[model samples]
Target chain A: MNLALVFDLLLALMLLWSAWRALAAPNATRAVVMFIVFGLFLTLAWGRLDAPDIALAEAAIGAGLTGALLLDAVRTLGESAGADAGGARSPWRWPVLAFSPLLAVILVVAVLEAPQQLVDLPAVVERNMGLSGVTHPVTAVLLNFRGYDTLLEVAVLLAALFGLLALAQGAASAATRESFLLHTLARLATPPMIVVAGYLLWAGAHQPGGAFQAAAVLAAAAVLLHLAGLLPAWVAPGRLLRLGLAGGLLVFLAVAILPLAHAPLLTYPPAWAGALILLVETALTVSLGLVLAGLFLFLSGRSLRDEETR
Target chain B: MRVAPVLRRTLAFALLWWVLVEGSSVSWGIGLASVGLATFASLRLWPPAHWRISYAGVAAFAGWFLLESAKGAVQVAALAFQRRPDLAPRIIEISLALPAGAATVLIVNVLNLLPGTMCTDVEGKILRVHVLDGRLPVVEEVRAAEARIARMLGVTQ
Candidate 1:
């Protein structure tokens, strides 16, 4: 077999092994960690398949954020019942094991049976790319051609955040401490990294960096502050904070509103479209980072200050 | 009974609604009526009248936050590839300098945004975090984060 095929097989094996371990690991922490590894491997596989955007998202959101959340949940559960108390075991473990692999095999078969090449690319994407007015093909498809999906995705994110907040019912306090090394690192590294993240956001119009990537980077920074105890858990978002949350929706709505004035829905002014997209992406990065962080902290159910007392 | 802040928040929500539903042009009468109704409803819902704005503090905090997040991303990425992931798990407790509210929430949420660390709990002024690689000292990280947040909330410390 060729090198590409060999690589795909190895990745597929890694995914399967990790997934199996994640499901069967006796410890919840190990299970979560395994699942995270599975997610990373899945991203690598997607990259091999030439879907870099999906890979980036899967790595950042699926592996990184989701893993952190799962680990938090596991830690909380462990603490509540005393540190030595292991979580309850699944009663249907055997049945689940029997069924899951079968389901996976079926999925693999379906994927293999799918058509190898695009059947209507020219008419579907290339033909209508100009009409959308966005130079980026994926963005065109996401914001214009299939705008409804993008709207729904945003709604899903918002809903998930709100639902998580409702379930968790409290927030964590900030931690306070400092060391020479952390101070030096933060001072030397933070500015340049933020600049890079901004550059990535701006370059996303023609390159791989976009709202999602930029937001991941931003969220990473936010995570650092939380770790350092620089941010607090109980600080409520204000009117402007609310505005930031609603910014993306507003921009999209404005774009759609223009359609009623004889312009196509989401069609930007020709000269300023790039600038507008950049603006929207930047807003989205901040909003997304904040939303995800909020969800995690809320679910953790303790303020940073409270944490220190324990 | 405090009414002004509730009224303001209601007005803000109405404005947001208007912005969101841009093309659906209802008459000005309807918009004004809705705003008035919202304000009244909000007053009843939030019987207390206490709202504060600290713009300078928030700006400082945001500036500090952006910087902190960048540092975190690099640190976590490096940790992920380390030979001994297990040796790095550390739990640290941080003291809070701000009041229990939005600023605090922002701090904890931002912590989770970074990789390799998760906020375990927050009570009063203390914040607890679980670091994947806990061997490293977390105090400095906490101090820097606190300084930024203190600046953001206009709390002198």
Candidate 2:
């Protein structure tokens, strides 16, 4: 095999090995760490596949954000049960074991037997690139060609935030004590992060970034804010908070539906495509940032609340 | 909390935008607005407070910290590959003389990068640190870093 092919094989094998270790690790913490490593490997694989967008998402969301979430869970749960205490339970049981191989076989067959030429949609999308509001094919597809899917994704993020808020309200909030170190780090990092997010939002029109990756980075920064105790003890489900949760979806819907009576749903006039897409992506980034960070706050809230109740 | 740092930070962000956008003016109009919001939010969240940062001192401190941390990192790498690491890890506690702002926490955070130490928890002036090698003069290094950070923040003594 060529070097590139050999590299891909090794990466695939390593990914599989890590996946197994992540699932089969004796305790939750080790498994969680392994899973994060697996995410890093998967990101590399995606990069090798010439999908920088998915690589960024995989690293930022799949590994970084998800790792933080799992670590929070483990830390909170472990303290109560004792670190080693009942953490050895496998997420998989008999049903997963019995059904997974068949699922795997079906997936492998689907990959092997798949037609080389599935659809001419990519060619069509390329031809329509000039008419598309954005230059990036992924963005064109996500925001225009399949705008409906993105709208639903925004709604799902908002729903997750709201659901977490409901769960966190009854629980005690994480205390935000004044700490100099975290405060400084967050402050020093925030301005640059904001600029980067904005650039990503704009570059997404022609590059590998967009709302999702930018939001993930912003979410990480917000988590840093929380860690620094900059956030309030717990966010009250105030009017502003609720609006922030649904703001992206509302903006998307408004943009999508307001003109629908004149034309089909989400069919932006050719001239206004770029502006409209930018508007939607900006709103999407903010709301996504809030929702993702809200998840993080609630996760830490559980830990802080657990400590107090104990 | 002075206006100077705020202005400086805003200007710094503008420079960052240059790098991020690769000097493309096409979207600077929108990017500047985001930068403004971020600058405001950042200052609001963590004001200068009592920090009176000296640029020269900060530069010097940063240089030293980076150099020391590189050494620490190398040592840790070697230690990790050892078949049997001579174990002397311990939780050593130290109380800060610096004020209650980010000075203590900032130093603690830096200690995490300084090879063997992980700043575990802090309660007021007291710090509970986990150093990977108790034999190393990690405490001295921490004290040195803290002193430099305090000076950088214009904390007297």
Q: Write the per-residue lDDT of candidate 1 for residues A79-110, one digit (tens) a residue.
A: 33323223346577678868998999999999
TM-score, candidate 2, is: 0.82
Expressed as tens digits, the lDDT of each residue in B87-114 for candidate 1 is 4577788787766655576567767765
Write down the lDDT that model 2 would get: 0.80
Clashing pairs in 2: A180-B101, A180-B102, A181-B102, A181-B106, B1-B48
RMSD (Å) per prediction: 14.0, 4.3
> What DockQ does each listed candidate score?
0.02, 0.51
Stretches of candidate 1 exceeding 4 Å from the true structure: A62-64, A79-91, A115-119, A176-180, A267-275, A300-310, B1-157
Model 1 chain A: ten consecutive residues of lowest lDDT: A79-88
State the local distance difference test value for candidate 1.
0.63
Chain B TM-score of predicted candidate 2 relative to the true chain B: 0.90
